[model samples]
Target: MTGPIEGWAGPASLGEGSVLTVVGAPHPVLARLGDPVDPTDPAVIRLAADLFATMAVSPGCVGLAAPQVGVSAQLFVVDVGAHPKTATLHGSFALCNATVVEASRWRPGREGCMSVPDLTGDVKRASRVVVTGQLPGSGQSVTITTDAFEARALQHEIDHCSGKLFLDRVSSAHAIYQRKVYL
Candidate 1:
């Protein structure tokens, strides 16, 4: 289903997915830039599904990127519907070669990642953003304009696909914290 945001018809269906292992911090793949992929390729479709499945199985994970799963590809999955901070819900969707076209209203918010596992940071991100990406399977292009937590989640995942982590966005060591809970 399309989110409350206008014009997004939502993502095309990605077939069956299997949970893939999430690579932790310091993994070489996480530091390398992801390569662009053909959205309609069978392998790309499967990777989209697998990212979604892996996110689903991980507690408190709202997004996942191919690089986090040890693949250096420009792809990620996000679903922030259940988060209390989310004001715009896009449901679960995978985007290939996504790019941020516009961003504004910068603010710092607590962020974490399944790949990092042990740290959370206060990162400055746009509270409102416009992003464009191609959907897997159909290779359909979609533009999403969103705000609040969903926007933050999207930016976070996109950063992962670009080989950057939340830690990279923190202002200083004071902005980073050791995560005390994992569930």
Candidate 2:
């Protein structure tokens, strides 16, 4: 699936072909780890843009990863500024080859995914985190330190790139619940 990035028109205003069909649970690509993307590549830039677009249009979706859109690349975009639970307002941004450098404290919270639309689960996540990654086109090193909802969102998206789902981290199978609503 190597090619140039494409764009589409949407409320997110990113471009066409960016608001991709989010792959669902049990899809082979969603369960497979993603490869590192060349941040300087034009295609990667397009992917980043698509990711941002997809996130913007997805209700209650503050983050999105390459795997979710069926691209096996280590890329994701996040924006928690509009979230009511957001503690810190960081504007939307994209990253490739992201890694968590520091994490501390653990707490449980309910989480849902576009990939796993039928379910939501209670999972434990780090309360604070520091993530490092290459910026989309600049290829510059960017580090992010965040807590609360943003931290949870980051970890969730990064997990997708690593082939892990919130279902894998749920405290127990019983904690999983059917999602009747998505917004």
The 0-to-1 C-alpha lDDT of every candidate, in the order given, reads 0.88, 0.82
Model 2 lDDT at residue 168: 94
Off by over 4 Å in 2: 1-17
User: Which residue pairs of candidate 2 clash?
Assistant: 7-15, 7-16, 7-17, 8-15, 8-16, 8-17
Model 1: which residue pairs collide?
none
**lDDT (C-alpha) at residue 82 in model 1:** 84
Residues 94-148, candidate 1: write the lDDT tens digits: 8899999999999999998988888999999999999999888878888998899
lDDT of model 1, residue 101: 99
Q: Candidate 1 deviates by what RMSD? A: 2.3
* Residue 174 miss distance in model 2 (angstroms): 1.3
TM-score per prediction, in order, is 0.93, 0.88
Judged by TM-score, which candidate is best? 1
Which regions of candidate 1 are displaced past 4 Å?
1-12
At residue 49, candidate 2 shows an lDDT of 83
